[model samples]
Target: MFNMILRVTENPVRRTTARDIAIIAVFAAITAALGLLPAIYLPVSPVPITAQTFGVILAGAVVGGRRAGASQLLFLALVALGLPLLAGGRGGIGVFVSPTVGFLIAFPTVAGLIGWATERVGAPYRLLPGLVVNTAFGIGVMYLFGWVGMMATTHLAPWAAIVALAPFLIGDALKVVIATLTAKGVHASYPGLLRSRTARAVAGAA
Candidate 1:
């Protein structure tokens, strides 16, 4: 019974395909492109608010869990290789050790969790549920890491770090709304995209 329940709820792991690779690459590029948007520096926090997170949310919302996560991982790999893919055109192995590392590392997890949760919402994903999933994972979970990153780098007390992180919440909230709406539109136009990878694999084997 436990196995059956797991089987029913869990996304079946499947082999990656060329299409998956293409999708991952495309989303990674989309994320990098968003970084080109001017970052808004906040006097309160060292981390600047950028549009990159919007791409992160959209990747998960549109691509489902594994691919979304893969896309983020790919993006980071390029950044790590010294590509100026981050906001303010900043990138390199050095960025990984900086105050923003926690938030930066959280990208893949954020996208993956959002994608997985979005998939559970099923086809024709609606606006409210999408908003809820994106908000919870994208902002709440993502910030949890960001807070730790701030503390680690700046040596701030927990409360102090939380206070510093407060300024970005409003901006993240807005991104969540826009990403959710955009994802809903995408799913509406490209039905089954959330399940595309799995569906394709199943179809191919038949």
Candidate 2:
């Protein structure tokens, strides 16, 4: 029974389909577009508040884990290739080494984590569970990585660095709520867009 439970819960590895690639590419572009939104810079921290994280949340919630991560990775790859795809029109190799680098590094990772959690919440994406997963992964996990990145790059004390990031919490919280609602709508309309691996398997068997 225990083994059966594990099997039922497991996310089976599957090959990416062409449709997955198209969705990934579209989300990557959406991420870039969100970067074009005006960034609000705070005096306390070097990182600016932008709508990009909103894109990150949407990518993970709308698409499944692997594809969402791939989309974020693809967006970062474009940024690295000298496109000005970041907030305030910043990009290229230098941006990767900049103070915001840690947050940038967290992009793909957080998206993947968010997708994984969203999948665990299963289909129909309930409001509470969806919000909880998005908050935990999108804000909590993302901030952790960004905090570490800032300390390593700027040589700031840990407490001071995290303190500096306090201003971003409010905006990010709003993003979480908005993204969760948006995802819920998408899941309702599409129904099959964000299904868990187990859910997909069950559907196939049916």
Residue pairs with backbone atoms closer than 3 Å in model 1 (clashes) = none
Write one digit per residue (lDDT tens) for candidate 2, span 125-174: 78898888899989988999889988988999999897877778877987
Candidate 1 lDDT over 115-205, as tens digits, reads 9998887666779889889999999899999999999999999999988888788778888999999988888887768554466567767
RMSD of 1: 10.2
For all predicted structures, in order, the TM-scores are: 0.83, 0.82
Shift in Å, residue 133, candidate 2: 0.3
Model 2, C-alpha of 115: deviation from truth (Å)? 0.7
Mind sharing the TM-score for model 2? 0.82
The ten-residue window of minimal lDDT in model 2 covers 5-14
